[model samples]
Target: MATSTASYTQNQSILDALSRCIAACEMCADACLHEENVKMMVPCIRLDRDCADICRLTAAFIARGSDHAKHVLKECIEICRKCADECGKHEHEHCQQCAAACRACVEACQQYAGQA
Candidate 1:
């Protein structure tokens, strides 16, 4: 269910990926909060929040065509990978969905970051 950003500039794909990752992370964090064993989900929740925040910053940098956007994208890919791995460890549907989105963002960012 990846969204198409073909009409946008090449870097726009990275923005689209970040947007998806942010939404997914937010949803996953909320879902983790509602889990019966909330204590067990602390790491996942923290990662999700961190990932979302980073993704937001990365997207803003990219949107503004800042020189530092490349560095941000590199950092973003790392956080996205960590968030995806953490979410993948959970059985919740939202976690699973978030993991997929994070992974997608990782790939997109990595691809664009290389060109940056």
Candidate 2:
């Protein structure tokens, strides 16, 4: 049987945050690749990709009302924090924006986790 998400009404905010974070991370990663010092941005780019993927998965888990949503959210929070830290080290506009998005995602994940 298909899972119902009717009980997950509070997840809407988390979903929105995840979506924004994914976009920001993707954009940051692509911008990093085009930077003159691509080598220096490898860590940031990698973290951005990781953050985006984790957020995507977390969103899916929440949307499906999966039993493992909280577990996935824990990992998502960790990755988002790491990505934010890494991105915050850079002076690039994209990096700064990505950091902000990651931070927002972390907050949303934490809030959802608390309610779970």
Candidate 3:
């Protein structure tokens, strides 16, 4: 039997959030590298990359309806929160935007976890 379309459709919100978070994180990391005091943004850049990777993995797991999706989402939530915290410490527009995206992704992951 074919997999239900509902399986993929149900995760659309999280998928969208993950995509946004990935974009924001990549942009933020690149922007941070160009900052005057790049040394100060190391933590933020690291977290952004970490968060983006985890979000991508989680999105993949959820999209395939993998049994590991919930487990990966737990990690995604943690990393997203950490990334947001690090980005929140920065004053740059890209960092702020990335922080917002991380926060949104965290919320979406949590909601999906609850439903799963």
Candidate 4:
């Protein structure tokens, strides 16, 4: 009964949010790796990588109008929120920025994820 032809890419705001989050996640991971206490940042770095990868995949699923787009978005929201929470624990500028981006992505994903 739902519109199965939806194209995620057509939603500029969501696409932009996802793209920004992906970039932020990558940057955060790199910054974490260069921190003096890199070992302590292992969890953040791992989450950042995971968030970025999932964001990218979610975007692709949406762009292709996949039947699984809603499911992908739901997963993306969970990871983005987790990543944001982890980054929020750090005081680094990169982590702060990453957290902001992750929050934005979560907000965007929430709009359509419930339809899954």
Could you say which candidate leads in lDDT?
2
The numbered model that scores best in TM-score is: 3
Prediction 3 TM-score vs. true: 0.94
Give stretches of model 1 more than 4 Å off. 1-8
Clashing pairs in 3: none
What TM-score, to 2 decimals, does candidate 4 have?
Answer: 0.88
| TM-score leaderboard ranking | 3, 2, 1, 4
Name the TM-score of candidate 2.
0.93
Candidate 2 lDDT: 0.93
Q: TM-score: which is higher, 2 or 4?
A: 2
Which regions of candidate 3 are displaced past 4 Å?
1-6
lDDT of 3 by residue, 1-116 (tens): 24466556668988999999999999999999999999999999899999989988998998888998888999999999999999998889999999999999999888888878
Model 1 lDDT per residue over 45-102, tens place: 9999999999999999988879898888888989999999999999899999999999
The per-prediction CA RMSD against the true structure, in angstroms, equals 4.6, 3.1, 2.0, 3.3
Q: Between which residue pairs do clashes occur in model 4?
A: none
Tens-digit lDDT track for model 4 on 1-116? 13433543346567789999999999999999999999999999999999999999998887776888887888899999999999999999999999999999998888656543
lDDT of 3: 0.92
Return whichever of 1 and 2 wins on lDDT: 2
Give the winner by TM-score: 1 or 2. 2
